[model samples]
Target chain A: MIKYRQELSFKEALTVILYTLLFNTVIAIVLTYFLKPFWENFVFSQCIGILICLCMLMIFRFITTENPLLWLLTILSGLLVGSAGGFILGAFLTEKNPLVYIRQYHEFIRIMSLGLIFGTIITYFFLSRVRISQAEDRIQEEKIKRLTSEKKTVESHLKFLQAQIEPHFLFNTLSNILGLLDTDLTKAKLMLTDFTHYLRLSLAKTRESTTTLSQEIDMIKAYIEIFKARMGERLKYKFEIQDHIGELPFPPMIIQPLVENAIKHGIEPKVEGGEIIISAKKDQDFLRICITDTGLGFIEQNNNGIGLTNIRERLNSLYDDKANFEVMENVPCGTTVKIEVPIVTD
Target chain B: MSQIKAIIADDEKELRTYLKAQLADVWNDLIICGEAKNGPEALNLVDTYQPDIAFLDIRMPGFSGMEVAEKVADRCRIVFVTAHDQYAIKAFENEAVDYILKPVTRDRLKITVTRLKEQIEVSSVPPSDLPAIIERLMAELKANQKTDYLQWIRVSSRDGIRLIPTDEISYFKASDKYTLVVTGDGESLIKKPIKELYRELNPDVFWQIHRGTLVNVNFIDKVSRSLSGRLVLKLKSPPETLTVSRTYKHLFKQM
Candidate 1:
């Protein structure tokens, strides 16, 4: 069934006409099959069926999207119009006067009732099938959308796992530690202790989803220590945190990956290996953390790696629109990533 | 008392220290004369020290432990130390060569030490099954290291079945039924469709510039606007320019 709009398109109007003809033809065939012997004007009765179907269609077209009473009135008016159409055809076929036709008004009433019943039933059944098919198509589309999103989630999770284990960083740090063992024993010892702590924290169950801000900071500190050992004198970094912000809840591995990105993309590419400044500040209901590196800022085109993208995706999933992550240029030089997360107290 | 010399080679110092401490507790005569952090260094140590036994971590920087084991198999008896579990160690189960899992406890070290002592007492050379065990382990590691990235493409050309590196390809164009794999060497034809090939290539390198065109970003010389305001990609080689449709023009926006 076609729903009413401001105006029906050519295709929609054609569909309406086609359905009307089909339903009316079926009703006429059924009527003729039963009353063919008694009715002499069988062909005339078929023409009357087509005329009455046209009346029903016109009534529907004019009052489909109007008030409920108007629609009820339209149905009642359609029956009257259909009966009148049948009477005129009967009068015309039998070559009788209007007064003579009035005697057989009961026959006209029966034909009108049959037309109304069959027309409503066929229209309702056809509309129900169309609506059901439309509903099933919508359901299938929703299922496909859900499966595609699920696949993307699983793929991102796998990428997150891979990012957690930086084999290049690991091997380089191990080699740096070996190099340090020959010259500086104390520094090597310090690096090894931090490396083991970092490994332990990374493997801990807390890192699977959530961790306290202080725990994430501790992991970042350990990471910085390992990086400092590897880069040595070429890289420098500092951290500033507001008082009492340590115990706030934060996602694990989020801040650490950003800091890693800063070093890998920002500092390591530069010859001098610039300094990084990480700061955390509290503002009303939001906690803002900024990681700024003094390296080749926006000049590096290949800066969007899995780590930064994963951070953004995880943030979106966790906080929806409440959290924000932005990458902007630092004043003097380099890039600054500012993350603002809602402070949740427990 | 006879002194048994041994070499400990692991990328991590902590593991090496723990293994040495466990060995000292298990066998007093087994002295670790040298330590190497990587495979090449381990090979150098085996040559210089000529140790009776060598403990090699399977995953090491540079050459890796399996490669080192091959070079030192003639002179030293080998024990592979790996982070992989017993399932991965199934290749070593039936062979004469032994393997110990990581986070090695004192008991596991003692077992390996006792086996080494027994072997040394029996013969100077390695057991006959050592070569076969190493070969199997190498094959297993190689199989595990195979990644999902599209590394090479097999093309049936007039030159008779050439395997071309995907990295050498500058771009791909779909023509009729076959896709043309254009490389610096020459253009090759592959039966695989462009859509299927696109999924296998690294997204960072190969970008879909058009509906039927995929170009490697490294080969891109410049992106310029045409008189008709359409974006055209000027490639470095073959002197061919590809038109970017309005739908895919965002790919060149950052350039």
Candidate 2:
């Protein structure tokens, strides 16, 4: 069974009727002057032709679904049926037997041939017009889809750039190093060493698709050390990881941004800075990494921050449904973010 | 001439010490009277030492540097110290206000000191229009910050989390380590500190009546004075009376 491309509406049917009437009136005027038949008889015959053709088209539409073959059959049958009905009805209205035109074979053939030619031209015009519109609609839909996908790519790229280097963190750490140089020489050396390690790891890892879990944890340790010096005595941290889990391959920069969020939104804002705990362990077929902070409890402002959203997008693209991210309020105070991804051993 | 006294206020101890060392190298006669690690300490240092100059970092705990400046603009000549704040730097430049960038070098400190000394010598009489300029800068900064005050506060109840709209809250009272969010329904405890909540709340709607209490102005029913002439507030909901501290009693002067 063939399917119909589109259903006809009442407005389209009305437009077709109006066009047919206009075309018939033009043909009737020319025929009246050339054939020398009465103008009234010509108009009367054309009206009968229009009525018969509309009735036949309506019956065909009700019985069969619309398709190219159906349309062709309707148009060809309408031409033959309408011309025969018009000739018989016109002869009977002029007080003659309806069979008089059928008896003149030459006149009957000429009138039927004219009807076929005119019907084919009109049908081709309407069909081509509908096809062009359908093609334009398809193109428009494809354009919108392409634009939306392009926009998504650009937005994610911009987010990646923002996640790479935070200007405030860079400048503040530099200022801390500058200050430490004059007061504590050995401490300054330690900070410089850790800062170098952090910059090298972050810059290098961002270029690669994945890294061992140990490397990401090393970068987080370096980050916490820099903050430890800057926030001296106020900031504390602990890392707990199961043995043999550090060597597993994981997506790079996933856990680091969450740590940054905890510091930026939770710890740094509080009067008494708090501790951050990073723990990783394997559970069944997945690796669970949790970062917990003891600072101000979860606030709505953190929800809109780019850090959390960026991490969510990265996880979705990399692991799809195999990864899970969750945020929960700690029991006493602060927030804990958990990430669980499938552990692939290869 | 008497020795010029100065105070340095920054959250980081290293920045404070570094700035002090740079000042000592440039201006020998200047005395470093005090150092503050946060905003409240900075204000306290200014009040006690009566410093001639104050170097206030823009971002600090308890209150921001701009907030501290708003309180002590008249007590000392203000020189803002910041790491990198684009909007604030632009505002400072436009107003011709004195400011210094962090990781202080000797050259920048020398310039700031020279400028401050001349200003102090020229205006030893009274406070100038610096306060007005500071106010404008603060307003601009707040506008740029797009500070949308807390509309809904999430609190834990007996069963689960409860989100209460700010309009429904009557007041917030500080307890031991948590704050009590009192409403018409009852009170729920939150882990957020009163001081931090004060900074997040809209100042016009929630007035800090005491160090430990913040009363929503819309919920205030009556204002009366005690026998000792201390101000007291009567709230409509929960129908409780709150005492106003000496520092914040001026907020109810009109009533």
Candidate 3:
């Protein structure tokens, strides 16, 4: 019996079942005759044969059909054809006791009634199994939908976090340019062009998700340049990315926030300037990005704002907590933002 | 030729004062026709003063120095003044009449006035001719600059040219005859002639800081001027001090 929709075969399954039943019936009759040569000459034999064939056909139809009305019609046809064949065969094959073979009419009628009842019950079982299978499919679909939605939300946040960086940088650079006008025009003019170049870059990358890590690092470098241009020599940054991890895929704008956090809270707040260190490497099958600043170490009060919260939420949404992102002190110096995720590939 | 009387156009009151003082200090003969705090004021000043020289700031709250320059057209020869040196440098590179960097360095402004004197002395050309000259200068600079502020170079080894954005490059090294572009993680060796690249690069960004070498100024970690007056540039990648060749040594002091 085909329980699930996937197992459902229309006309083809029906023909295979009927052929198997017909072969089985022929074998039964041949064995009965060869063993007792009586069924070939018997008047009741034809009636018995017709009854057996009808029962098998109804069961086959019931197992295959899902439509309840079609099942009932098929089962009823089985009974009618079985009885009509029995009566007609009895009349043609009987010699002396034709009425006697036909008189076993009650047995033939009983077979038809039983066939209808058994066929309906069998079909009911298959339908229930079919329903169970469908429920399982629905559950699997929901799981997939949930996972996809989670990925989308996380990605959107990652992109948001990344996008947030450029604007903040733009505004800050603009402020620097503005500040320069009152004191130093030449430097401001240079920074303005640098800032413009940075902005044009951010605009160009509006479509992609995972830019090459090298490209991203360059952008960060550009951003740092703007600060350097403004601060003169007040800020310094270093890259310690492992050589092997250079070609790895990473979320866009992933490292930018940590850099900004270092700048906004770490370096900018202090006098005499500070240094920012960025490093990336593969540790235990994961790509780990670490951003450390010489600014004052992590203070709970300053970082509780929506930025970290948003980053955390985005991380959760993307990797389902598979990625590890944390903010901790770099011991004697300052804050370090470490982001660890599976090494993704393009 | 008539005297090139000029108005000082700046949004900041102090810079305006500085321009007036500096202009007067440098060229004692330059007539200070007037000064305006905004573009409209500058325009009105240009109209009333009919000054031959107008010192304008590139960025004003409402209108830019260029916009004001367009308006003054033939009335006065204009010089843009802004604190940002690169833009001003680019303007001059573009063949702009002249521009002064902000803080209005006394010596630079003095040079500006001398240029103004020449423009005023030779100022018989029509204003219609001025815009065209400016446009031609801009085109010439654009075509002449080899690096169009390239963010990436998409060059292909397989296809003969792969375009890699300038921003994608982490650092560049001069490899004998060709420049080796250490791209993010995936590096590529580009066949750029070092000397030609130096001539074509934006000095403020891609500096041909070293002989046979060009470095993205964005990637420079520390730059120091040596005792011999050569500039040494340190980058994050090479972890070494790259000395600015004597030929290109003059550039480091500007930043």
Predicted model with the maximum DockQ: 2
Q: Which pairs of residues have clashing backbones in candidate 2?
A: none
Candidate models: Cα lDDT each: 0.72, 0.77, 0.61
Fnat by candidate, in order: 0.00, 0.31, 0.00
The lDDT, on a scale of 0 to 1, for candidate 1 is 0.72
Candidate 1 residue-wise lDDT, A1-35, digit = tens: 33431223335445666776676656656666777
For A1-346, candidate 3 gives per-residue lDDT tens digits of: 3332232233434543464345435544655655454544243334644464546444653457687677666655655565456545655664445455457877545534443343344435444655787788779868986896777666665565455554434544565566567577887787777677666655555456566677778777777778776554557889998886666766666676668778766776454458999998888778888888877654421333346645655665566668876555555667667788876644
Q: After superposition, how far is residue B239 of candidate 1 from its true place, in Å?
A: 35
Over the true interface, candidate 3 deviates by an RMSD, in Å, of 24.5
The candidate 3 chain A region of ten consecutive residues with least summed lDDT is A1-10
Query: Can you tell me the DockQ of model 2?
Result: 0.13
* Candidate 2 positional error at B189, Å: 22
Residue A51 of model 3: what lDDT? Answer: 61
- Candidate 3 Cα misplacement greater than 4 A, ranges: A1-169, A178-186, A316-321, B1-255
List ranges where model 1 is wrong by over 4 Å: A1-25, A30-215, A222-250, A253-313, A319-346, B1-4, B83-87, B94-96, B145-255
Judging by lDDT against the true structure, name the best candidate.
2
